[model samples]
Each structure stands twice: as structure tokens, then as C-alpha cells.
Target: MTDWRSDLELITDAARQAGAVAMQHFRQSPEVWWKNEGRSPVSAADYAANAVLETVLRSARPEYGWLSEETEDTSCRLERETLFVIDPIDGTRAFIAGLDTWCVSVAVVHLGKPVAGVLVAPSLDEEFSASEAGEATRNGVPIRVSRHIAGDHLRLAVAEDLLNRLDPLFVRDVERIKHVPSLAYRLAMIADGRIDGTLVKRNAHDWDLAAADLILERAGGSLVDLAGERLVYNRAKVSHDELCAATNADLPRLLRHLGLGLQG
Candidate 1:
């Protein structure tokens, strides 16, 4: 098998390069277009960053298949044992709005699991990376999830709708973090101990979670469905259902409070 550590290095570098490309168009009012039936926005920076990531990562790992949000999907990836899954510029809306919460996310998935991943937020000067064989890191320093227990006033980056669904008593003790436009960054926050947990709504695609999922896992956290099953990637259907992310120490309580069964 290929060295997952090396794959992590490869994506970390590629993400950095792609992030730099995106920065050129950030806050510059780069041209924008709509996709997903006009529900989503795509900017020139997204495509430019995608181009850089495609060229750099693919050239270095031609044998690996490719799947990028900016690129059209293809069945060719299904034939390979390993592939690169990318979101050239995650949180395009935030980036276009001149916010610094967006990031360039990239990951290497092998046999339906992420072995390596990187998320670079250029505007924030933050770079998160992890491999199956290594601990999660931000800017080269090892990081882990927060160890806050359930009774504590846990900090959560969650959607308003989801927050309202929880028991009021449970909600009372929780501190709701302001909305973070980037789902990827929000999850990364949990990995680096910035928050206690978050609830992810349905319809999130692989590109949005794959890289950060691995990073969160390496940092002693998990991203799982309501049933507490961990996520799988690179499948025919890339989109995921509602999910929850938190450090292992707090995940069970979060799920319990949400009325979900314990994670297996």
C-alpha cells in the first residue's frame, strides 16, 4: 500500500498552493456564477484554485483517480483503488462575501476510507492535515479535540434549526457558536479543540467532509450519522445524511442529548 503519511504531505502542499491561487481572487469581486439550479454560487477563484489543485495533485499521483467539486464527476474513479477528493474552495459564499472562514479541502480516499487529508484556510493562515498513521495537525502543531463533558456548557457550532430540535433543557447548557459558513472549517475547529461539537445537516457532499473527517478522526473525534455509524466516502452517491461531530469523550453525550443511540 502507498504510504498514507506521504499522501498527507502531498495534499497538504497541494492545498497550500490551491489556497494561494484562491487568495488572488478573494475580496476582489471575482466573477460569480450559479450552479445546482442556482442554489449555489461558484466564483472565478474556485475554478482557478481547482485548476491548480487538479494539475498539481494529479500530476504527482497520476495513478490515483480524481473527484473535485469544480470538476464534473466521472465513473472513472470507481475503477481505481485510491482517489483524490477535493473541494477547491469550500464555503464559496463566505469567500465571495469577503469572509475568512473558507478553505481548500483535499483528501486521499482508499477503499472507501480517507487515508490522508488537508484543509488550508489561506485568509486565516491556518492549515490542518492528518493521515491514518499520524496525529492531526494545524500549522505543523499536533492538535486534538476538546475533552469537555456533557454537563459542561459545551460550545457547539450548529445550525439554528438543528439546535431548536434538541431538548430545551439540553439546549440551555450549550453555547451556540455563531454560524460558520464553511462546514469543513467548522469540523476542523472541533479537531483543533476550538469547539465541543457540531450538527451537520443532510445533503453535504463528500468534498465537503472527507478531508476534515479524517482530520477530526485523527484528532480523537468522530463524524457519524444519527445512528452513530461513521461516514464512508468515494461511493456512487457522494452526498451524506444528517451527521454529528464531536470528540470521543463528548460524542456519546451529544448523541444521547439528541436522543440518538450511542456510537458503536
Candidate 2:
């Protein structure tokens, strides 16, 4: 059997290499286009990175199944026990706009759960990774979720819609809210202790949140749906809705505020 650790190392390396390819194209003025009714943007950089990532990963593990945002999906993955789930470039809007918040997100899913994950944000000089049996780390240092209490003093991470829809109680207590275009990076921020928590009502795709979920969970954090349910992966439809991610601080209150109960 192939060593999962070594396989993960290869995946991590591939992700970084792909990130470099993206940065190179990102330096130049690349064509950016819209997809799915302008809900998401795709750039030349995205395809460039996807090509590199797919080539490297497939060569490294020829037997493993493949799933990626920029690649065509196939039913062959259903028969494979292990698969690679990836977003060649998350936050394409940020990338196309010459912003530095995008990243290459990759996850190793075994039996429908992520066993390893890596999120490389080259521009931010940050790489967050986690293994099921190992520690979660940013760069080389260990990281974890914050245990801070949420109140009038706590900061939050959210999209603009949620900010507008939140109850006055939540709005009043949240000391600050930072908008991050990439959901994966936002969850990674929670894992790296950069933010308190993030809430979203939209169903996030498995590829969008898988890597960050493992990173955060291993860092003593949590990624739950509005029902306070753990995020699941390898679904037929790669999208998810109504998810929240945070360090275990004040989670109960946040769920209550959202009128949700803990899920099994």
C-alpha cells in the first residue's frame, strides 16, 4: 500500500507548485471570465494552476481518483476509496482583481471524510495543513482555535448579507467583522487564530470547504452547518449550504442566535 503521509506530502508540494504557477500568471494581466451567472469568476490563472496541479497529482498517484473545481467531474471517482478534492484557485475574483487573498486548496478524502488537507496562500505567505493523525500547522508552527468569549468585544467574520440579516443583538455585540472573499481562507483564518468565527448561509461545495474543515478541526476548531452539524464530504452534488466555522468559543450562543440546534 502507498504511504498516505508521503502521498499527502506530494499533494502539498503539488499545491504549492501550482500556487507558484498561479502567482506567475497573476503577475501579468490575465483574462478573467464569469461562470454560472456571474456568481463565480474564472481566470487564466485558474486554468494554468489547474493544469499544473492535475498533472503533478495524477503523476504522483495514478491510481487515486480525481475531483477538482476546474476539471470535468466523472463518475469513476465513486469506485475509488481515496480521492483528491481540489480548487485550483479559490477566490478567483480576488486573484483576477490583483488581490492577494486567493489560494490553492487541496484535500485527501478517504471513505467520504478528509484525512489530510493543505491550503496554500502564497501571496499571504501562509500555508495551513493538517493530517488526520498529526497536528495542524501554519508554515511550521502549530496552530489552534481561539477560546475567546463572544460578546460586545468579540470580532466576527461574515459576508455582507449575513451582516445585514443578523439580529440587532448579534450586530451590537460583534466588535468587528472582516469580509473575506474566499470561504476556505476564512475557515483557515479561524484555524490559524486570525479570526474568532465565520458564518454563512450559502451551501458551500465540498471542494470549497473540505481542506479548510480538516485544518480547522485539527486545530481544535469546528465547522458546522446552521444546524450545528459537522460538514460532510464526497457528496454527489459538490455544494453545501448554511455553514458556520469557528473556534469553540461562544458557539452555543452563536447557534442560538441563528435559531439552530446542535446536530448529532
Candidate 3:
């Protein structure tokens, strides 16, 4: 019988190895390139780390499907019940800029949801992992979300664009805002108590947020679209327009105050 836990362990190790490779090339003044309209950037480190992850993951489980930001989309993944969703070298620009915030992210998606996930940030010396049926952990220690009481100053972490789009009232009341480029690391920060919430808007991709989404949820936090709906994976479209994640229980009121409607 296949040991599902062992498979997760294998992938976790593979993700860390890929993260190490990424850290090696990050901040080395490498070449950067653009894709999909010259707005997004990819560096040599991203490809190098992606190559490592693809090789390690494929060799360990060739039967499993693959979906990665740096790789071409293959519809074959839609047929497999289990697939690897990865964002190797997430935060390429941060990495290139010598920031210690980039990471390698991996998720094992089964039946359209994440069953096991890992986020490795070598430069920051942090690694977060979770299983669908288990608790979230950082460097092997159990982690939980903060229970800050409501009606206090709400912390809202967001992309600069999303911050700019928010109504002035909401923006002024935000206790704090962090301008982090890496989506995965930002959500992980929410899990780590570095931030309280994140509001994401247009052009966010699945690979950018999948692993961290699970990490946040396992830490007693939540990830949802602006409509307060759960985020589903392995969809037909690769990008999302309005997604929000929070570590607070007052998320509904928070969304409403931000001028975004929420659903049940």
C-alpha cells in the first residue's frame, strides 16, 4: 500500500531542497525576464529552482500531475486525482533585490483541494507545513493564529494597488499595512503573527497563494474571496480578481467596511 504520509514527507524534502537552490541564486545580480505582457518578472533563479522542484517531484511520483507558475500549463493535470502545485522561488523580485522574504512553496492537491502543503523560506530561516487532517507548524513547532479582540484597530496587509483602491475611510483606520510583494510569504506572515490580514485584488494566481492559504487556515486563520467565499483550487482559470485572507474573526464586518460585499 502507498504510504500517503511518506509521500508528503518526500515532497516536503523536495521543496526544501528547491528552496536551498533558490537561495543560492537570489541576490546574485542575475538576469531578469518578463512574461505575459512585460509587467511580471522572472529571474534565472526562478528557473533554476523550478527545474530542481520539477525534477525532484516528478522523479518521486511520475504518476502525479504537475502545475507550476514557471512551467507551461498541461491539461493532463486535470485528469489526475493528485497533482503538485508549486511556486518555486516565489518573490523573484524580492530575491533579486537581496531581501530575505522569498520562498519556495508546494502543495499536494487532491480532488481540487490541498491535502498537504509546505512553504520554505531559506533566507528567512522559516519553513511552514500542514496537512489537511493535521495542525500547521513552523520549523516543527505547532502554530496558531492570534486572537485579537474585535472593534480595535484592524490590521490590514495588502498589495500597494489594493491599498490604493481602498476607500479613504478604511485606509485611514488600518492599524498597519505591509507592502510585501510575495503573496505566499505575506499570507505566511499572517500565520506567523507578523500581519493580521491581507486583501488581494486583480491578477493573483493560484500557484502564488495555494500553499500559504492552507498554512493560514491550519493556523486557525481564513482565506476567502471578497465575497467571503472559500477559495477553491484547480479551476479552469489560472488567475483571481478579488481574494482576501484574514486571521481575525471579524472578517465579515472588515470586508464590508472596505466597501466589498461578503456572502455566506
TM-score of each: 0.95, 0.92, 0.91
Model 2 worst lDDT window (10 residues): 255-264
Candidate 2 C-alpha lDDT tens digits along 1-264? 334677669879999999999989886889888887987788898999999988998887888888999988988888888899999998888888788888999999888888889999999998999888878999979998776653335567866655656677667777556678888898888887777787865656888888888989999888887778886677677787777777776676676665522232
Q: Write the per-residue lDDT of candidate 3 for residues 11-103, one digit (tens) a residue.
A: 789888998887677767888899879988899888988999999999988999999999999788888988899999788778888998888
Candidate topping TM-score: 1
Across residues 1-264, which tens digit of lDDT does each residue of candidate 1 receive?
A: 567887887888899999998999999999999999999999999999999999999999999999999999999999998999999999999999999999999999999999999999999999999988888999999998987654678898877766787778888888999999899999999999999899887799999999999999999999998778998888899999878999898898887866432221
- Model 3 misplaced regions, further than 4 Å: 1-4, 159-172, 259-264
lDDT of 3: 0.81
Ranking by lDDT: 1, 2, 3
Identify the leading candidate in terms of lDDT. Answer: 1
Whole-model Cα lDDT of every candidate shown, in order: 0.91, 0.82, 0.81
Ranking by TM-score: 1, 2, 3
- State the RMSD for candidate 1: 2.5
Per-residue lDDT for 50 in model 3?
90
TM-score of candidate 1 relative to the true fold = 0.95
lDDT of 2: 0.82
In model 2, what are the clashing residue pairs, if there are any? Answer: 202-241, 203-240, 203-241, 204-240
